[model samples]
Target: MTSSTPRRDTLRFITCGSVDDGKSTLIGRLLHDAGAVPDDQVAALRDAEGRLDFSLLVDGLLAEREQGITIDVAYRYFSTPRRQFIVADTPGHEQYTRNMATGASTADAAVVLVDARKGVLTQTRRHSHIVSLLGVRHVVLAVTKMDMVAWSQDAFDAIAADYLAFAEAAGLPAPTVIPVSGVTGDNLVRRGEAAEWYAGPTLLEVLEGLPPIAETARPFRMAVQGVNRPNLDFRGYTGRINSGVVRVGDAVAVSPSGVRSHVERIVVMGGDLPQARAGQSVTLTFTDEIDVSRGDVLAAADAPLEAADQFEATLIWMAEAEMVSGRVYDLKIGARTVPAQITDIRHRVNVNTQEKLAARSLALNDIGVCHLSLGQDVAFEPYEVERELGAFILIDRLTRATVGAGMIRFALRRAHNIHRQAIKVDRNQRAALKGQKAAVVWLTGLSGSGKSTIANLVEERLTAEGRHAYLIDGDNLRHGLSRDLGFTEADRVENIRRAAEVARMMADAGLIVLVSLISPFRAERQMVRDMMPDDEFLEVFVDAPLAVAEARDVKGLYAKARRGEIANFTGVSSPYEPPAEPDLHLRTNQMSPDEAAEAVIARLRAARRLTASPPFEQPPLT
Candidate 1:
């Protein structure tokens, strides 16, 4: 005898597409027809003009109502006699694409809406690709607003064929196409009489019939979140099980350390459990006193996970600041955190056309294939195999803000191939050979703040006094090394990174290196400070108010910014963070350029950065 598949009781899904695709209306209609909406709440959905507006039900925010658009992901719960449903109505605007990704991250299915009049748009394709990337196997292409097209079968067939072709090209599972009018309730609850010739299941029928996604059969994995010891009587490791099942006597291995142990007991809120399955929150008591702490993964001993420090991943840049290669960030997966960097960008995918485009950096909402190198080995699995162990977020270390989301593909072999090479000639030897202390004088300020002028004067004064000095001006280097970069927040970070690296190299060669740049972000400046020894880097804040800098727009850049001809311009469109406690502060309004140079020279001498044995002479102020 054959057995029948079990019926799923709950469905999790999201609605996404281009702006004004009737997603809100479709959800509101579903809730209303299913009697999910209360009578009093239904009465409250009317606008000031007293029009029957369904979208007012879910557009709950004041900003959303005023703008007449959804800005954030809004979740709604409703149920039918056969099944319960949780719907995430994600914003369709291009700027809020990150929020859509966040909503789709946990969904088992997706309802991608498309306006019958608009057909398939760029956002439609973008949302489809994201749903596929997130592992949502079941998809519904809701061709909404069928009443506008007179319920024409030809129009519906054309869109369905186009989407199927796109799905094939993008390697996404084909979606079930449906013709419905969300506003008029055609083919929504029960098939309306709008289309007489068409005979298909209603939207609710298709949704209720979708099978529940099967749980992964992979070996047990749990990230240790906390060590619980109410008293000396008992000790347990507390965390939510990520995959598979664990029993009381199950043998386990701690990853990244390779420690082996056996579970003695499993404790839950109710009591001790003989076994715990995936998604259950429980604590386990170990039979042995092995070393285990937070940020460590405990897995089934039979199938230990791979420990690696490097992997290739699909990255989605989420910050307004673009992504910069070679910059370290906090890579957080489950409970573990490691310092990581995107070493290289291989390519970016064009969502609208499904084409691969070469890219060096990723901007906001950009998806690309990149290489990540971690500070230490971590237990990981490919996202296709296990989501909790493979999905991660990139956090800006200094700002303590999330900047990107990534899905690990696989570990790379070249990670172990690269090793640090040591040399006999160190910094001390290089400094001794030049007969002077090596240091980097970092100058930061707003545009036209006299930083470049003061830096040029300081370098000239040092060179005339028989000392080796070099000036790494920001603008001059931009014409060469950073020529490919722009004024986005991410590019600004890279610009400073390249300049600081060059300055460090010159300083290592036993020369005084002066850097003049409008390094606006405090985080970037602090990163540069942490790169060298305590006394080797000095931050000089060339102070000038925004009014003063705008008045002295030497290149007419500020004027262009005010006229909307330039964007991300500091003190205009973007922001500039001044140093909180600079090593040297120069108020250009109160001191001449020569006076500033002399003050810097005096400070260097006091710090022992210059010795008198070299027969140094001070340059005249004139």
Candidate 2:
């Protein structure tokens, strides 16, 4: 092996393909051939006959060794004189597709192993699609098992042609197809006896010749992880630069706040520096004291990224649960974490066939095109332009688990269309004019659960007390405001969303709004709570047994739902996720509607939410 070359650069790549495609063997062979593995470790990987077992070198986990399958992404570091390398050996099973994605996220290149006998399997295309989706521009199709195919020229050529066609169809750049035998160490570090017809650089050669990353030419962007203020005298904004260069005195903008300042100093571990470039983890001192904190993007003033809340994106559903539209997720992109929701699922891609099929939800390992609505406008770019700025991970708000990996395609046009218009008369001014505290009491439960009856009673009592109040009844809203919505899960979420928004608006207009709806989904209920200010929104769970509601189905709605005539009807076809904590929990069976309404009024009075007159002046009792 040639080991003498200058100007070494580290290239990060991952090995992935269908099961038993020789990915771990390929990486292990590279390590062994390059003298990266110690002599003792090499000895440990040998069988009783003293022959090498290449998979043993990389599949170091006990379970992996026993099962002979990779369960986790095993990262291996090695180097040649020309370049250093970080090779990730990813699993091939569909269940571990998320592990493969995690490995490929930061990769500069991908080596997708294809067994000559199997040709292009389903997972081979899956890995290729994911590699391209992750913006790994350099791809190496390692057509392995030349020895098993007896070094047949036709076998290698056929597999290579099919893969090239598939890659081209998938909009991936043409890959460098190398015929190799990972088990025999053929064409790994050097050309071997196999594949006499093939005349191409070895896998290591291709990697060494791959283009070096040119981050200095890109726009300056850094994701702030923290504000390092060890003492009040010295403060630094610390983060790894994603792209471009930042020099002292350079004008910078901190987003999504859009605060602008000049870089007064650049501090590295050694001391202060004149400048800092991409990939370096350094701290920056700004000329002006700005609110530059964690989750903010420090970008160059001239070419800052666009701040947007809505975008069209490609998402890889990593969770076992399917994608739930309107469910709020904590989207962690770069160093910033924001509340985000998948507003729409346009279509899901059949990875094996590359078909964009209509889909309502994305299952595990499913790649889909969806629309995302973030809580706040933040700096971002299309993933093709900048992976760091455009890539994100969706975390489950309740479970705190990472559910999906996403790449922003582009900011939706509606992101620009929907701008917050500041009004002169705010909610406080409107509340002051009404001379009472305005709040929303959202009643939710099963169908025929006395929500409407209790809401009417509450509104009547409020009217008698001369309180400005309005009730947004569910059926009335469906007749006018939500007339177009259906009873599907998505439509139900939208229905409740519209109702909550209207209730919030009414409450903002100095009116106590009572909303009566069977908003079954807890996610949408929580979404509504998030829309209003704390304490302004009160969820009133109109509790009633399913049997009780079904027995009292005066309109025969529950009977229709049981007969399957009403599809997606809550408590029958769909599900009702009860709130873990509701402000008011009313057992309708135990209390009459009048009693429930009075109890709610009592709660408001106890919380001091009701307007109270001045107390009688007490006589001076010194």
Candidate 3:
């Protein structure tokens, strides 16, 4: 007399595969059979033979419809009698890694499609690995277009075997496999008389019976998004609990600070709460007046979060611009944003082959293991242990674009081992001893722009006035300081980093450091500027036209660059990002080297950096 009732829980899943693997078709077909698609839409989607074009239901973008390929992530909400579904039809193209990542970031489960004829592919492996990284709890291998292969059981078995092996190696859970044909509507929502050898539940049956995503039981943790001080009467910390549970009177501690506190009230919009769990946003009032601020994490008192400034992580490069080591980027983990740099790309991962390859830089869609160095200590756990505290995004500092996404593997041991040594003497002391303010004069411009000439003149003038100024020429740096560096954009970034560090060190030693380099990128120069004190680093733009600089190239560097001999030559091949607002701009072609040097000295005097130096006499132009 009793009949089984179907579960009604919603499942968020993504459909991803290599291009033309029938990802869109499979989704559309599923929706159509489930009776989720409107009759009008289905009628409009019919092809010449009166057969429904199942791919049209999800590929809603104009470009996607024109090209018949899913360009963007198309999210569709549909439900069968068994279960409700939120499906993200992700792109299958190679360059759409960013789009795939965006969709995979939130999905609890993933449906990886494979063409029956094509078998397992490179991108199939890549998407599988990414979804695994994003913590997709469940996976289903959808072998689409089974009708194309005449519903062959051997072909389905072979593809399943290949993918399962790869999944094991790539640290993914074994996926549920299903053979389904979009055209025939076989083995998708119902079992058609196509493959009697296959004896498994339909795709819909497996999905309906699947268990809910379970979060691992861990110590309570929440990154404080802000302190809610509505008025003078009440003050509470506000954030979503990243993991574990929190209750009133629960013993808690602030991380990286180790400050102890107890929860007084779990405040929500409805009023006081006795308890709160992970993923719930609430305002937590502390028993004590704890010195808690944004970017700080609250955790269980007994099990505080691990604090580190260096970590080895798996990075997925999502930007068009290649990822270069030693270039600083903003690492946004939870509510915390810190200046972080990929110190070294340990190795690039071959997603398809699962091989480790040597790599200095990672291009778009390249996955690599990188050593990250942060500006300050941050609270975190390994990504395997917890997703919320470990996953982060790399932001390009200048553009503020999210360039990469990474997951913390673990903290580097040496990060805790090395501490800043306490010194008796400091920068101010050294500057006072020298009786002049320490500074870095960074001269940026195109090559053959008389930067070295201007630097030499300025240094000579400063030294004559008893100012201990040091000149760091670009050519001279390559021979020693940056000998290992080349002219690639990544290399150029590192080169400027080394030069700026050396200049800072010299400046700290009470020397007026004059650094003359064709620092092409404005972002790199900005990085150098941020390393110094306010107004202490003077950006001097040595201006010169491309034709003038090329004509003035005595070493034949520009000619070689133009003739396809020398690579990454500034003003010839490589781009030069001139400073938008320079402390001083000198037209090298308009002024003699002496005049340019005098102008710099004048600017420094005006800024009070040349307090001890007298006015320099400019030599007459020949």
User: Per-residue lDDT tens digits of candidate 2, residues 122-150?
Assistant: 99999899998999979999989889989
Q: Rank the candidates by lDDT, best first.
A: 3, 2, 1
lDDT against the true structure, per candidate, is 0.87, 0.88, 0.88
Error of 3 at 95 (Å): 1.8
RMSD of every prediction: 6.1, 4.5, 3.6
Model 3 has an lDDT value of 0.88
Q: Count the backbone clashes (under 3 Å) in each candidate.
A: 0, 0, 0
The order by descending TM-score is 2, 3, 1
- Candidate 2, which segments miss by more than 4 Å at Cα? 1-7, 47-51, 612-622
Question: Which of the numbered candidates is closest to the native, going by highest TM-score?
Answer: 2
Badly placed stretches (over 4 Å) of model 1 are 1-9, 45-52, 229-235, 396-401, 419-521, 530-538, 542-577, 583-622
Q: What's model 3's TM-score?
A: 0.92
Per-candidate TM equals 0.77, 0.94, 0.92
